[model samples]
Target: MALEFSPETYKKFEETVNRYPKKEAALLPVLCLAQKEFGHLGQEAIEYVARLMEQSPARVCGVVSFYTMLNTKPIGWHHIQVCRTLPCALRGAERLTSFISKTLGIEVGQTTADGRFTLSEVECLASCGTAPMMQINDDYYENLTDEKVTEVLASLK
Candidate 1:
C-alpha cells in the first residue's frame, strides 16, 4: 500500500523539510521520526520514509543497516542492551550474557519467543564506572548483579 501521512505527521514532515534547505538532507531525521513512531523501520516503513524524503530505499536501507540504533525488524517489548566494553566485560559481561540467555531462553540478537524481551551485547554506553550495566529501552541500569538483573526482569511482567 502507498503510505499516507496524518495531518500532524504532515505538519511534522513540513517542519523537518524546513529544517534543511533540501529535502534529501532531512532523510536521517525523517527515518529517526519513523523509528520513534513505529518502534523500528521495517521494509515498508523504510520505503515510506525514503519516498517522503525523495530518496531511494537502497540509500535508506544502507543507513539503517550501518547504524545499530536503527533496527530493521521488530524488537521485544523490552529491549535490553548489555554493555560489552572493556570495563563491563572485565566485570563479568560474558557471565551476565550467559545468565540472560539462559533466563530468557534466547541468544544475543534474538528476542524472546513471546516477544517480551531482546538481548543485545552492545559497545560502550559511556558508563564505564558502572561496569556490568545494561540499558532497558531508554533507561540505564548499572552495577548489576545476577540477582539484581533477575529481579528487574521479573518486575517487567
Candidate 2:
C-alpha cells in the first residue's frame, strides 16, 4: 500500500507549499509535516513526500539525511538528545551523557529495551549559554547535575 497524509494534514501541506515561491522550496517543511504524520521518515514516507514535492526519492532522502532533526528510522518515545559541542563539552556534557547512558542502561544511538528512551549525542542546539543541556522530546533541561538528571528522569517516569 502507498503512504499518504490525512485530509487535514493534506490541507496543511497545501498551505505550506503555497507559502513558498516554488514548490521545491517547501521540501523541508513538507518533510517535517510528513515526519509528524508518519512518526518517522521511512522509505515509504520519503517516497510519498518526494512525489508530493515533485522531486525524486533520492533527492528527498538526501535532504532527510542532511538534517539531524529529521528521523529516517523509528526513535523511542522519549528522544534524549545531548549537546556535545565545545561549549557543552566544556560544561561536562560528556559526563552527563555517560550518566544518562548508565542510568538508562543504553548507549549512544541506542534505545532502551522497553523502547521508552533513545540516547543521542548531537551538535549545538543553540543553547550555548545553557551549556551542558539535553533535550528530552521537545523540552530542554539545562544546568544539569547528576542529582538534577536523576530528578528529571524520575519525573519522566
Most TM-score-accurate candidate: 2
Whole-model alpha-carbon lDDT for candidate 1: 0.88
Against the reference, the lDDT scores of all candidates come to 0.88, 0.93
What would the per-residue lDDT of candidate 2 be over residues 63-118, giving only the tens digit for each residue?
Answer: 99998778888999888999999999999999999999999999999988888898
* TM per prediction: 0.85, 0.95
Off by over 4 Å in 2: none
The window of 10 residues in a row where model 2 has the poorest summed lDDT is 66-75
> For model 1, what is the alpha-carbon lDDT of residue 58?
97
Error of 1 at 73 (Å): 1.1
